[model samples]
Target: MVRSRLYKVTRGTLRLLSRPVRRAQGRGGIVLEPYRGYGSCDEIFLIGRVFRQSRPAPDADRDSLRDLWRDVGRRIARRAVRGAAVTARFGGTEQRVATDRDGYFRIHLKPRAMPDCADPWRAVGLTLDAEPPVEARAEVYVPPAHARFAVVSDIDDTVMHTGVANKLVMLWRLFVEDAESRTAFPGVATLYRALHDGADGEQNPMLYVSRAPWGLYDVLSEFFARHAIPAGPVLFLREWGLSWTHPLPRRAEDHKRILIGNMLALYRDLPFVLIGDSGQHDPEVYAEVVAAHPGRVRAVYIRNVSADAARIAEIERIAAGVTAAGASFVLAPDSVAMAEHAAGLGLIAHDAVATVRAEREAAPPEPATGPLPGVLRPTEVPPTVVIEPEGGRRL
Candidate 1:
C-alpha cells in the first residue's frame, strides 16, 4: 500500500511537470513536433518567446503575441512548402511540406539542388504580421561529401563584429542587437555564398568552430539569414553562467584547439580550411592546426581586421606554415579579396582556367615605347629574394 501511494505521488508530479514542459516546448500555439512527418526534408526548428510586455490592456497580452507568432509560423510554412517559388534566386529550386495541425514545416530538396558545400543558402522565407511585416529567414548549408575540410571561423569580429574581449559589450551586442541593426562585413555574404554554391553546386563540406556558445544558435541563424550567408553545424565553446563563473568554461584558444584536434581525428581523411580574423589567437590556433595536420589543411583565410604590423606578420607566418605543408595561405582585407585569392589559388573556379587565360591574352594592354626606362623594366625575381632583409639575408 505504501509503494503504491508513492508511485501515485510520483505520477502526479510527472503529470504536473509535463504541462510546463509542453508549454515550454511550444506555448505560442505553433509547436514543431519531431518525427511526426519530417522525412528526408530540410527541417528548421523555431523556438522563441511570444510575449509583449509593453501592451496597454490585459486582453492585448501574451496570448495576442502568441497568436501573432502562430500566424507568422504558418505563413512561413506555407511559403517553405512551396519552396522554389519563394527562394528561386537563392538556389532553392525544390518543393517542401508543412506540418498538419502542428507548427512544423519541412523542405524536400533534390539531392543536387541542396547546398553540398559549407556555404550558406536561403533555406526558408518567413513573413510575420507586424506593422511593416516582420521578415524571418533561415540559412542552411549541407555538409560536404567525405567529411573533409573543417571550417574554423572566429565568432565576434569575423561574423558579428562584437568586441568579444569585453564581456558586457559582447552580451549587449548579442542580446540587444536586433536583425535590422546588425551589419555584415562588406562582400562577406557574396564570398560565403559563392563557397556555399560551390563549383556547379558540388564541393567539399565545412565545419564551423566558434568561440560563442550554443545559446547563440538562434541569433546566429537569424544573422545568417539576414546576411544571406550559408549555415553549417557549429561547435561552440561552453559559456559560464549557471554552470560556472567565467564566461567561457575553459580558455577560449585552448578549447578551440582541443575541439579542432578532436575533429581532425574524427575526419582524418579530410582536409581543413581555417578562416578567422586578426583580432585574436587565430594565428596561433591555425599554426598549431597546420603543424599537426600538415597536408590535411587545404588553406587558411585570415581577415585583416587590425592594421597592426606585428599581427599581420604573425598571420603571414601561420599562412606560411600552411603553405609549407602543401596547403594555401591567404590574408585578405575583405571577402572580395578573399574570393579573388581563392580563385587565383584554384580553391574555387570563377571560370574555366583555359577560358580565363584566353580572355587575359585577348585583352588589351598598355602600348609600349621601343625601350622603357630601366625602372620600368619588368624583371622576374625569385620568390626567395622577394623579401630580403636589410643585410641581404633572405626572408
Candidate 2:
C-alpha cells in the first residue's frame, strides 16, 4: 500500500513536470501509425496510434555512438494526438473510431464476407478526418484454411539472448542496442523458418508475444527482418507505465496468459506449438494454458536458460502436468534439440534438422558481458533430460 502511494505520487509529479514542455512544442498535422493486426475469418482485430507529427526515421547506417543516441531519441520522442477521428475500410465496410488519450485506437471488424485472396495479409485502408485528410494502409493476417498448425513463441529469451532475469542488463539490451547489434539465439532463424514452412509445404501461422512495451516495436520488427525469422502477424506487447518504481511490467504471468488465451480463441480450429524459456514464469503460465485448454496445444518447447537446481526441478514438475494434459513438454538446452524433436513429430521437415545444426555450429559466439551468475549458456550445460509425465526420458 505504501509503495502504491509512492508510485502514484512519483508518476503524477513526472506528468506535471512534462506537461508544459509537451505543450510548448509545436504540433503538426495528424499522422496515423498502424501496427500489424491479425484474426480469423469471422472477426478481425487491429490497433494503431495517432500522432501530431510523422515518426522520424533513423539513419540507414546506424553504427556510430552519435547515430545510436539520435536514433533512440527520435524513437522515444513521440507526440500523440488525442481524440483524433479515423475511419477503417475493408470488405466493403467502413467503421469510424476515435483515438483515446494516448492516441491509440482499436478496431474490431466482422466483415459480411471477407475478400477472397490467396495472400495471408488483407489490407485495411485508414483515413484520418482532418482539413487535409490523411490516408494510410494497414494489414491484417488471416491464416489460410489449409494452414495445419499455428506457432506461438515468446520473444525475449526464447528467440533472442536477452538477459531478462537481470533488470539492468535487459534495459541495456532493450534501449541502448540497435536492431543490427541485437542478436538472436543460434539456429533460431532457421528453426522458426522451418516451423513457418511446415513439413507438407504448407504455410503455417506464426505469432509472437512479448512482455516488452510497444515503444520497441520498430526495433523488434527490424530485428526479425534482419535475422530472417518468419514474421508474425501481430506482436502482442504491453504498455509501459510511467511510474519509476514499476518501469518494467508488474504482472508478466497474467499478461501472457490472457494474450495466449485470446489467440487460442481466435484460431479456434488450429492447434498451437507453444515456445518459451525457463528464465521466468513461462513454464508456470504455459502449464495453466495446457490445463485450461486441453488438446489445443500440440507441443511446448521450453529453452533451458536457468542453471538453478531448484528452478529446473520445479520446471520438471510443471512439465509433468503439461504432458499429462496430452502435450509434449520438451526442456531443451539448445535449438538443435528442439529442431530434432520437431522433425520427429513431423511438425517440420526432417532435413531441417541438419540445417539448424549447421547454423548452430557456424554461428559466432555471444559477445562478452562480464560474469552473469545463475544464467547458464547453452554450451555450458549438458543436454536437459526430458521428464515424461509418467516416466522420465532423455532427449
Candidate 3:
C-alpha cells in the first residue's frame, strides 16, 4: 500500500512538472501530427505525433517561403522530437502519451467500459502547450452494431484525379495547388457521403487508406473536409528504401496488405467496402485483401481510371474473386454506377444515385491532359516516384 501511494505521488509530480508541449516562445514551432484511428464500443486506438518544432535560423530571413529550396531546407532543419506531451480526450477519459525519439506516439484508450455515443464519429481533443495554446483533434470512428459496412478508399486518381501515372504532371499539379485548388473527382463527394450516412441515416464508419506517405496528412485532411467526404481516419503509409547511397524511393504492395489486414483484425465483425482506382494496384492489392480476409469485405469498388481493356479484364477477374469470397465487387467508371451498386446492396439509399450524378455534373471537369504515355499505370508497374496530392513533391 505504501509503495502504491509513492508510485501515484511520483506520477502526479511528473505530470505537473513536465511541459513537453511548450516551446521557447515562437522559437520552436509545434505540429500536432494527426492520423486515422479505429475503435469498438469498448476501446479506441489513436496514433499521432508531436514534432520538436522547426523554426527558421537567424539567417533564414533572406530566404522566401516560395523559394524552390525552401521546403528542402525546412526538412533538413526539422527533427523527430522526443518527450512532447500529447493527449487524447473522449468519453470523459483522457489518455496521454509522450512522443518518442522519432516524434511518434500512440494511444490505446478505453474511454469507458460501456459509455454510449450517439454518433459513430467522435472528435478527441489534442493540445500542445503554447502561449496562446495550440490544439488539434483526431476523429475516432466507431461503427454501431446495426451498421452494415465500413468504407476504405484511396485518394489519388480515385476520388481526386492527379494523373498519378505520370510523375512530372502529378508533381506540377501537387506543388501548384492548395487544398481548395486541388480537385475531387465529380460525384465522389455525394457517393462517399451516402456511404457514410447509410440508407437509414446511421453514420457508418469509413477510412481512407492510401499508399501515399504520411507527410501528406495535412493537405489530404483538408481536401476530405473541403470535399464533404465522409470524415473518418486518413490512413497512409511511408515509402521504404532510402539510404545514403540509394536515393530512389520504393513502395511495396505488402504495406497496403498489412494495413488492411490490421483493419480487418480490429473489426472482426464489421465488413468493409474497399474503394480505389485502377490507375494503381488497388485492384490487385484489394483483391489480396479479399483473399486474406474472406468475408470481412462487404464490397470492393474499383474506379476505372484506366480505360484499357486488359486492365478492365483484370479488375473484373478481381471482382469475381471478391464475389467468390462472398463479397460483391464493382468496376465503375463513374460514381453513379458505384452508388447504384451500393444501393442495390442496401449499403446506401436508392435516391443517392441521382445525387451523385448531379454533383458530378455540377463540379468542374479535370484538365484535358490525361496520363502521359509510356509511364506505367498502377496495374502494369509500380511507380518509382509517386507522391500524394499534398505534403510531398517527390516520392
Task: Output the number of the TM-score-best candidate.
Answer: 2
At residue 333, candidate 3 shows an lDDT of 68
lDDT of candidate 1 at residue 40, scale 0 to 100 = 17
Across 21-50, the per-residue lDDT of candidate 3 in tens digits comes to 222323357667667778887788878766
Candidate 1, lDDT over the whole model: 0.47
lDDT of 1 by residue, 1-395 (tens): 97985554444333321221222111233222211111112332221112111112234233343444433333223211111111111235433343322122334344334444343333444433334333344444434453324455665667555655445645545544544445555566656655544555544444565566443555565677887766655656653221213333343434788867865665566567677766677767887877887777766777666655666666665555556666666665556555665566545568533333443345343122112222211243212111111122222
| For model 3, the run of ten residues with the poorest summed lDDT | 383-392
lDDT of 2 by residue, 257-352 (tens): 888898899998999999999888889999999999999998899998866678888898899899998888889877998898889888999999
Which model, 2 or 3, shows the larger lDDT?
A: 2
Per-model CA lDDT versus the true structure: 0.47, 0.77, 0.67
Candidate 3: list runs displaced more than 4 Å.
1-27, 54-76, 83-101, 112-116, 123-137, 239-254, 369-395
Report the candidate with higher lDDT, 1 versus 3: 3
Pull out the clashing pairs in model 1.
119-196, 120-230, 120-231, 144-205, 149-271, 240-247
Q: What ranking emerges by TM-score with the best candidate at the front? A: 2, 3, 1
